[model samples]
Every structure is written in structure tokens, then in C-alpha cells.
Target: MRKLANRPGGPKGAAIIRRGWGKVLGGLTLSPLMAVLLTPPAAAQSADISQKVKAECAACHTETGNSIALPFPKLAGLAPDYLAKQLRDFVSGARKNEIMFPIASQLSRADITALADYFSRQKRTPAMVTKPQLLAAGEIVFHQGNKENGVPACAGCHTRNGAGAPRFPMLAAQNPDYVVQQLQNFRSGARTNDFGKLMRTTVSRLTDDEIQAVAQYIASVPPPAGR
Candidate 1:
């Protein structure tokens, strides 16, 4: 496994090897128990914890990563490792959100993994309201890369179908508020560690309305099938 240098939008936590063979072991070479232990957890172990976490998450993140308002991304189908890293970021102050830090501080690494896994496993539903103007602009931004501005399409890295890779989080059904804040962080150089600083440059040029539109459009989109 190679250690990717800190870059924008990349995992924001202790320097765990970003890529590991654990994600590649197959069948009998890795027994189920071994797989469980070797693999970072994606969701919680018990109903009690799941319920507790869900309630806590609901205070900020909407059910399954959806937010009640713009910029709060839906959490339903993000990659578990990615989610865990974000939680770790909050706890370590690599990322700063007044509400998120304290809440994340209460969780153990295992707990973060479990919650992330559970959300990643869920299906993302659309936001009930979509502003027409923002949707139109966001649609253009999501599918069409802005070359002059040096912005890549969201699909370039998130994948055409929005199924993100390991450590790359799913953004299809995220809360717009969460997404906006994250993007703003990128623009401000606060959220570094992404691959190539792509998102930082992308968000830097966006107007507030553009941000809202893009976030809303992405959130309203459904997760890729089987996600």
C-alpha cells in the first residue's frame, strides 16, 4: 500500500495507509471472521448503538445523509472508510465544525466505522424540494466540466454513476448544507488532502448560488443502482 500525500478532499485523519490489501482479499483466503476483523467496520454492531447514533446524526445530518437544508449532504451511501475519516477529522480538528467536533469526539474509531458502514449501505432518497434555478445550473456543473475555470465534472472522480471508491465518499444523496460547507472548506484551503486539490479549485470559483445549486442537484440525485 502506498501513502498518498495530504491533498484536498482526501481522507483527513491520522496517516493510515489510504490503500490496503484488506479491501482485496477474497473468499477462503479471507474467512468471514477474518474479513470482519481485518476490514474496517462500515456500520454499528447493535441496534442500541445504531439507534443512538442515528438520533445523534439526525440533529445535523438528515436521515441517511440527507439534510433539511442546503449543504448538509445525505449520508445514506458514503464509503465507510471515508465516513470514518471525516469523523476522525472532526475529532482531531483537522476539519472544524462546532457541532460536528463535539459529537464525533464521543465516538471511538470503531464506532465511527460502524456508523459510516451502515450509512454507506443504505439507499439515498431525493430531497423533497429542488429549486429550479439551482437545479439547472447545478446540472450543468455536475455533468459538464468547466474547463476555462479548471473545474472537473463531479463525475470525473465520483464516477459516472456516483459509486465512490474506497476512501472516496459517496456524494449522490448528500445534504446540500454539508456539501456546501465541505466545498467552502476546499475553497478556503481548510479541507486539504483531496486528490490533486481538484475540489479546492472547483469550489473557489463558485458563487454562493452556484454552490447551493450544485449541492442541491447532487443531493437530489439518486445513488447508483446497487449502492
Candidate 2:
């Protein structure tokens, strides 16, 4: 009913009201889907990122998030939430990585989020196939399980294209050596971070050759668009 702009101290009151509104908006949280769709993408958030953290990450994984060395797994085009969880797991000792544990422990919640969001947006390059001969065998094992042994298809969880969801990791175009090592870790019970021991169970009965073949095929798979 009152026109504040026309009254004494109206301008200051309006400025205060505007600041209050900004705080309210800043405090509001976005839903998962909305956050992805509405937030300024990782590239645009560079100004707010910690240069020290980013540099450390780029030292192992290239600035683009692809690690050509094949020792550190590629991070490009992975789910941000998935990446965040891995970082947290490293800090919690759920995923025991001597190198990662200290680095992750130093990260604040904001740092973890920024790192995940940044890496997830980086473009991922397709991996090179080391064993061309095994592609066919690998394809079969990836798309269809060994029914006799009750092995479930890798695609059933990682998706047909291996653009994994928030819980599952992106397997397509990942380093074959890295994949093999992770599978072996799962099999040996060295890695227990997988929910419900799903990965351990899945790869438990798979032969070493089968694991290698699948990793090879997965390495060769070009990630689908918009992963």
C-alpha cells in the first residue's frame, strides 16, 4: 500500500531489501536435475576454482581430464556426483589410495565439488585398443554375460554405451590397464567401495582373460555423445 521509493530513506530501504533477496536466492539449493541444467557449467566457474588444486589435478590428469599415461584413470566426461563420491571415499578410507587419501583429506567440501564439476565437464578422448584380436570376445562379454556361470552383463549396470550413472563409473574409453587393475582389485577384495560389493561379485568368477578382453573392448569403445 506504501510507495517506499517516494518516502524518506526509501532508497536505502530498497537497497537493503535487494540485498536480503540476494541472500535468499543464494541460500536456495537446486535439485539434482535442475542443478545440472541451470548452473553455470564448469568452464564458466574457473574464476572461482582453487588454482592450487586444479594444478595438482592437471599434473596427473591432463588439463582436459584425460590421463594419457594410463596409470591415473581418465576423469573427463564422468558424472560429477560420481567423482565427488570417489573423493569423499578416499578421504574416509573407504577407497584406500595412499596418494589420494592425503590430497582428498585436505580438500574442503567446496573444493571437492569444484574439482568434480570441473573434471566432469572436460572432453574425453576415445582410448586406443591394444589387443584388436580380443574385440569380438570382449564385445560378447560386455553385452552378454556368461550365462553358465551366472555372470551378469557389464552393460546391464554400466549401460550399453558405458556412460555410467552417478553410482557406476564411465567405462567407455577408460584406460585398459586401469580397468584391468580395478577389476583385479575388485576380485581380490582390495577395493570395497563399490555399493553392495556388486563389482566384486560381478568379476569374481570371470577369468583373467575375460577381464582383460572386456577391458580392451571397453577401452576401444568411443564414448557416446553428451555423456
Q: After superposition, how far is residue 164 of candidate 1 from its true place, in Å?
A: 2.6
Name model 2 segments beyond 4 Å from true: 1-45, 48-50
- Model 2 agreement with the true structure over 32-120: per-residue lDDT tens digits: 67665666776435644647445567788887789887768999999999999999999999999988898889888988898898888
**TM-score: model 2 vs. ground truth:** 0.79
For each candidate, the alpha-carbon lDDT, in order, equals 0.71, 0.86
Tell me the deviation in Å of residue 98 in model 1. Answer: 1.0
Task: For candidate 2, give the lDDT.
Answer: 0.86
In candidate 1 the C-alpha lDDT for residue 181 amounts to 81
Error of 1 at 3 (Å): 63
Give the backbone clash total of model 2. Answer: 0
lDDT of 1 by residue, 1-227 (tens): 12343443346323333343334443248766775576554431555456756678876665555556554566776777788788888898877778788888988876787788777777777654456567878877888856777767887777665677775677776666677788878888988857667677778877777777888787677767766
Which ten contiguous residues of candidate 2 have the minimum total lDDT?
43-52
